[model samples]
Target: MGMSAGYELARRGFKTLLIDAFDPPHPNGSHHGEPRLIRHAYHGGEAYVRLALRADERWLELEAAAGEKLLERAGVLNMSDPDVYTFDGRLDDALKLGVRLEMLDVPEIVKRWPGVRLPDTYRAMYEPDAGYLYSERCVAAYKKLALKAGAELVTNTFVTDVKAENSIVSVRTKDDTFLAGHVVLSAGAWFKTLEPFIKLPIRAVRKSVAWFEPRGTLFDAGTFPGFTLGTKAGGYYGFPNIAGAGVKLGRHDTGVEWTPGEPFEPFGAYPEDEGYLRRTLETFLPDSAGKLLNGAACKYELTPDDNFIIDTHPHHSNVILAGGFSGHGFKFASVVGEIAADLIERRVSDQDLRLFSVARFAVAR
Candidate 1:
C-alpha cells in the first residue's frame, strides 16, 4: 500500500518520500507471498466490487507500462458445502456488475477438474475473469516506477516517531527527521507502534502458506484454476502449479497472535503449519498433496471486523491512516494508492470510503 501510494503521489507531481523498516518485496510484511488471489465477485460486500474493478484496470495499466506480467488470468473457483457457505452477496454483486460467473454443481466441477474430489453436497462458483497477482513483482514494479517518477525512497530505516501539528507532518527516524505537508501511514503489522498519535484496535496474527508437489499435470496451471474451499473444518485457498513452483496452499482463518517487532517463527515451527494444510489437501485435492516443496510465514493486521481502515486522522486530517487490511488487500493496492493520493490532494476520494472510515471503530481515538 505504501509503495503504490508513493508511486501515485510522485507521478502526480507531489514531492513524495516513502520510508520502510526493510527493503520491500522482502518477507517482513503481508505482500511477500508469490501469488495473491484477485477476484471481482467479492463475498465481503458490494462496495468492494467497484474498487476491485478499478484496481483491475490499474493493474493492467501497470503491466503494460512495466512491460512485464504482473497478473495471471488463471480464473478462480470458490467451492463450499451448501450448509457451511452463507455469503450469497458474492453472487448478487457479480450479477449486478455483469461479472462472468458460473454456478457449478458437483458433477460439472468434477468433469472440469478431475483432480478435485469433493462430496456431492459441495457446490462451486467459478469466475472466468478473476485470477492471481504476482505480489513481489508488483511491489518491485511500483518501487521502480515510484523512483523513476522522482520519489525518494528511504529503505532499511525504522520510523520512530510521527507528529502532526499546525498543518505540518514530521516523520522521525533514529538519525534524522523529515517534514511534509501530508503523510500516509500505511504500516502493516507495525501499526501498533504509532498508537500515541492515534489509537486503533488492530492486532497482528501469524499465518502460513505451503507448496506441495503435484502427482501429475492434473493440477497444473493450464488445467486447474486458483481455488478456495470451505468445509466444516475450516477455509482454505490455493493456487495450481505454475512453472513447477508446485501447488501453493494457505488456510484463511485462525492464526496465532504475533508481536510487531519479534521475528516471525519459521513455517514448521508449529505442527499445524504443515499438518492442517496436508489434511485439507488430502480431503479436497488429494492428487496435489504428494510432498511438501516449500513453506512461508506472514502476518495479517486485522481489525475487529476484519475490514480495512482507509481514512484520515480524526483530529489530524493531514495524516492519512491505511491499515488493518486483514488477509485480503493486495489486489486493491493499485486503487488504494490512487485513493490515498486523492485524499491528500483533494481531501476526498471519488470512491465511497465510508465503509473504511476510522469512525467505524469505537476504540479509534
Candidate 2:
C-alpha cells in the first residue's frame, strides 16, 4: 500500500518520501507471498466489487507502465455448500453487479477440473475473468515507478514516532525526525505502533501458507484455476501450480494473535500450519495433495469487523490511515494508493469510502 501510494503521490507531483522498516518484497510483510487472489464478484459487498473493478483497471495500467506482467488471468473457482452464506453473497453480488459468473454443479466442476473432488451437495461459482496477482512483483514495480517518478525511499528504517499537530505531520525515526504537511500511515501489522496518535482497535494475527507438490498436470495453472473452498473445517483458498511453483494453499480464518514487535514464528511452529492445509487438500483437491514443497508465515492486521480502515485520523485529518486489511487486501493496493493520494490532495474521493471510515470503530483514544 505504501509503495503504491508513494508512486501515485510522486507521479502526481507531490514531494513524497516513503519509509520502510525493511526492503519491500521481503518475507517479513504480508505482500511477500507470490500469489494473491483477485476476485471481482466479491462476497463482501457492492463497495468492494466497485473498488475491485477499479483496481483491476489500475493494475492493467500499472502493468502497461511497468512493461511487465503482474496479473494472471487464471480464473477463480469458489466452492461451497449450498447453504453457505459466502456462496450466496458472491452469487448475489454477481447478479446485481453484472459480473460474469458461471454457476457450476458438482458434475460440471468435476468435468472441468478432474482434480477437484467436492461432495455432491457442494456448488461452485466460477468467475472467468478473476485471477491472481504476482504480489512481490507488484510491489517491486511500484517501488521502481515511485523512484522513477522522483520519490525518495528510505528503506530498513523503523519509524519510532508519528505526531500531527497544528496542521503539521511529524514522523520520527531513531536517527532523525521529519516533518511534512501530511502523513499517510500504512504500517501494515505494525500499525499499532502509532496507536498513541491514531487510536483504533487492531491486532496482528500470525497466519501460514504452503505450497504442495502436485500429482500431475491436473492441478497446473493451464488446466486448473485459483480456488476458494468452504468446508466443515474452515475457508481455504489456493492457486494452481504456476511455473512449477506448486499448488499454494492457505486457511482464511483462525490465526494466532501475535505481538507487533516480536519475531514471527515460521510455518512449522504449529503442527496445524501444515496439518490443516494437508487435510483441506486431501478433502477438496486430493490430486494436488502431494508432498509439501515449502511454507511461509505472515501477519494479518485485522480490525474487529475484518473491514479495512482507509480514513484520515479522527482529530488529525491530514494523517491518512490505511491498514487493518484483515487478509484480503493485496488486490486493492492499486486503488487504495489512488484513494490515499486522493484524500491527501483533494480531502475527498469519488469512491464511496464511508465503509472504511475510522469512526466505525469505538476508538481507544
Candidate 3:
C-alpha cells in the first residue's frame, strides 16, 4: 500500500520519498505468500465492496501499465453454515450492488469439485469475478512503477520517529532527518514501535499458511476453485495448485501473539500449528488432504474492529495513519494507495473514511 501510494503521488508530480525498514518482496511482512483472495461479495460492508470494485479496476490498470498479468480469474467459493450471522449484511450488499454471484447447496458444490464433501444443510456463495493475486509480484510491480514515475525509493532505511509541530511534519530515521509537507506511516508491524508514545489500537499478531499435496486432479486448477469454508468449529481457506506445486490453506485467526523482533519461522515448526492444519484438512476436504506439506507464518496488524485506520493523526493534520487493514487488506491496495495520495495532496479524502478513523480509539494525545 505504501508503494502504491508513492507511485500515485509521484505519478501526480509530488516529490515523494518512500522509506522502508527492509527491501520489499521479503518474507518479514504480511503479504508474502503466493496468492491472496480478491472477491466482490465482501464480508466488511458496502463501502468496502465499493473500494474492492475500484481496486479491481486499479489492478487492471497496473496490468496494462506493467504489460503483464497479476490477477488470475479463478472463482472463489465461500462455504459456510447457513445459520451463521456473518454473511447477513454481505448478502444484502452483494445483491444491492449487483455483484454477480450464485447460491449453491452442498450437493452442487461437491459436484463442481468432488474432492470436498459437506453437510447437506451448508450453503455456498460462488463469486465469479473473484480470484487470487500474486502478492509479492504486486509489490515488485508497484516499486518499479514508483521508481519510473520519479519517486525517491529508499530501502534498508529504518524510521525511528515521526513527529509534527507547528504544521510541519518531520520524519527522523537512524542517521537522517527528513522533512515533508505530509508523511504516511505504512510500516506494517513496526508502526507500533515507531510511535510508542501514542496509544494506538493496533496489535501485531502472527498467522500461518499451510500447503498440502493434492490427492488427484479434483483439487487442481482446471476443476477446483479457491475456497473458504466456515463452521461453528472454525474456518479455512485455500487456493488451487500453482505451477504443479501444491494447494495452500490458511486459518483466518491469529495463532500466537507476535512481537516485532521475533523470527518468522516456518508454520509447522510448532507442533500445535501442524496438528491444527492436519485436523482442519482431514475434516474439511478429506480427499485433498493427501500429504502434509510445509507452512509459514506472517503478521497481521489488527484494529479493534478489524477495519482499517486511514485517517490523519488526531494531534497532527500533516500525518496519516494507514494501519489496521485486518488480514484481508491486500486486495484493496490499489484503491487505498489512491486514497493515501488523495489525503496527502487534496487535504481531504476522495473516499468516505469514517469507518476506519482513529477517533474510534479515542486515544489521549
lDDT of each: 0.92, 0.90, 0.82
Ranking by lDDT: 1, 2, 3
* Model 2 Cα lDDT, one tens digit per residue, 295-328: 9999888898888999988888888889988589
What's the distance in Å from true for residue 165, model 1?
A: 0.6
- Number of backbone collisions per candidate: 0, 0, 1
Give the Cα RMSD of candidate 3.
Answer: 1.6
| Whole-model alpha-carbon lDDT for candidate 3 | 0.82
Scored against the true structure, residue 147 in model 3 reaches a CA lDDT of 92
Query: Mind sharing the TM-score for model 2?
Result: 0.98
What TM-score against the true fold does each predicted structure earn?
0.98, 0.98, 0.96
The top-ranked prediction according to lDDT is 1
Off by over 4 Å in 3: 263-265
Q: Which candidate model has the greater TM-score, 1 or 2?
A: 1
The sequence of per-residue lDDT tens digits that candidate 3 reaches over residues 161-275 is 8777787787888899999988888777666777553557688888888778878787787577788988776777889877776788888765777777776666766786667
What does the lDDT read for residue 51 in candidate 3?
A: 84
Winner on TM-score between 2 and 3 is 2
The superposed Cα distance between candidate 2 and the true structure at residue 77, in angstroms, equals 0.1
